[model samples]
Target: MLGPNGAGKSSIYHSIIGLVKPTFGKIIIDGIDVTNIPTHQRCTKFGISWVPQYGGSWSDLTVYDNLVAIAELHIKSKEERLAKVNNLIRKFELQNVVNLKSKFLSGGQVRKLTLAMSMVKNTKILILDEPFAALDPQSVRMIQQIIVSLQMFEKISVSISDHSSRDLLSCVDNAMVLSEGKIVAKGTPPRSDKKY
Candidate 1:
């Protein structure tokens, strides 16, 4: 999704995740209606997860603890939770700061942590809103790589919304443009020589 401010990109994501209900439409996942389902149930039952624009973190908790907490919500066994957390930490290169409070992590680290937390339950559909906002070039590239790997290797379906489409053109298979809460265009992203 590519849109101007207040164009309802975030609203769509919220609605899908059960954070905000739609006034006149249904939300279906895997051909099942889930519009009225609770957020936790949607997550655990449907394998949907979301990462908001501002990274989701328990500021006081250590990176390792944050991952553990998220995993515990859907995973029953302590051994399973630990296994997932450890794998994510290693994949995101977070082991060096695993014991540090999330509040002390750099912007990039927080973003990576949020992504890791969202995957704790083996989410099938991952929604990210403004994932590349407020990050340096290196962080942006790193996150883009991770997103691609998640889809290619983990088989996760990823949906993302952002103001600029530059970073996403190469990663996404389809693009939609929204204006005033309505879709203005939907198709492949413009080629390098063309404008959207």
Candidate 2:
């Protein structure tokens, strides 16, 4: 989703993620009506996961610890948690900062960690809200690359909400432009490859 500030993009995210219940209509996911589902159940049962604006993380915990903590909550097997954590660390390229406190990570690394953290629950759909905000150009580009990869290679469905149409469109295969809580435009990105 591409929308300017206060265009209700985040509000839409909240509704779908169960943070804010919809006043009407069904919030369906994976062919099931999830409007009545709780926030945790939306993720645990429907395979929907999200990273909010500014990214989600435990500031005091190390990068590795953050990944491990999420895995521990969602995965029951001891061996499964270890495997999932290890895969996320390698997938996000956080090997160098594994022991570093999340508060100390660079902007790009923190974004990487948050997205990785969301996947610990076997996320089928990843929703990112304003992921491009408050980052330097380099970090922005890095995140763009990661988003494209997550959809293309990792096979995760992604919906991103950002004011920067150019940046967000570049990372997505399809897009819906929102204005004042309404969808103004919906279509594929100009490029079919969607290579950022």
Candidate 3:
């Protein structure tokens, strides 16, 4: 999804994830009607995971501990939790900063950690809001690469919302433009010479 501020892009994501209910329509996922389902059930049973625009993390906890905490929530076995955390650490290249508190991480590291935490439970649908916000150019490139890799290799359905559409169009197969709580356009990305 791409839209300027106040375009209700985040609301669309919130509605899809069950945080906001639709008054006039049904919310379905994987062929199931999830409109009335509780948020926790929607996440656990429907494999939906969300990463907010500001990023979600236990700021006081170490990077390693943050990953372990999320893994332990859904994974009961101690060995499994350790394995999952370790794998994410490696995949996100957090080995050197594993012991550092999450508050100390750079913008790119924080984004990586948040993404890894969201996928700890093998979520089928991942929603990220304003992922490139507040990121430096280098961090934006790094995060973009990671998102592409996850979509291709992990086969996860990823939905991303950004204020600007240019950077996101190249990576997405489909996109919708929202304005004033309505979808103004829905289609594949336009070529470089065309403007939204």
| Candidate No. with top lDDT | 1
Instruction: Compute each candidate's TM-score over C-alphas.
Output: 0.88, 0.84, 0.86
Per-residue lDDT over 1-196 for candidate 2, one digit per residue giving the tens place of the 0 to 100 score: 8888899988888999899988887898878898998998777776788888774899999999999888888899999899999997887678999999999998778878887898788667888888777666876777788777778788989888888776787788788888888999999877744657
Candidate 3 has what TM-score? 0.86
lDDT of 3 by residue, 1-196 (tens): 9889999988878888888998789888889999999899988897889998775999999999999888878899999899889988887778999999999998778888898898799878889998877777765776677677778899988899998875687677788888898899999775662322
Candidate 2 similarity to native, TM-score: 0.84
**Colliding residue pairs in candidate 3:** none
The per-residue C-alpha lDDT of model 2 at residue 59 equals 97
> In model 1, what lDDT does residue 18 have?
92
lDDT, residue 160, model 2: 86
Which residue segments of model 2 deviate by more than 4 Å? 135-142
Candidate 1 lDDT over 1-196, as tens digits, reads 9999999999999999899999998999989999989998987797888998885999999999999988888789998888889998998789899999999999888988998888787779999998888778877777788787788889999998889877876677788999999999999765662222
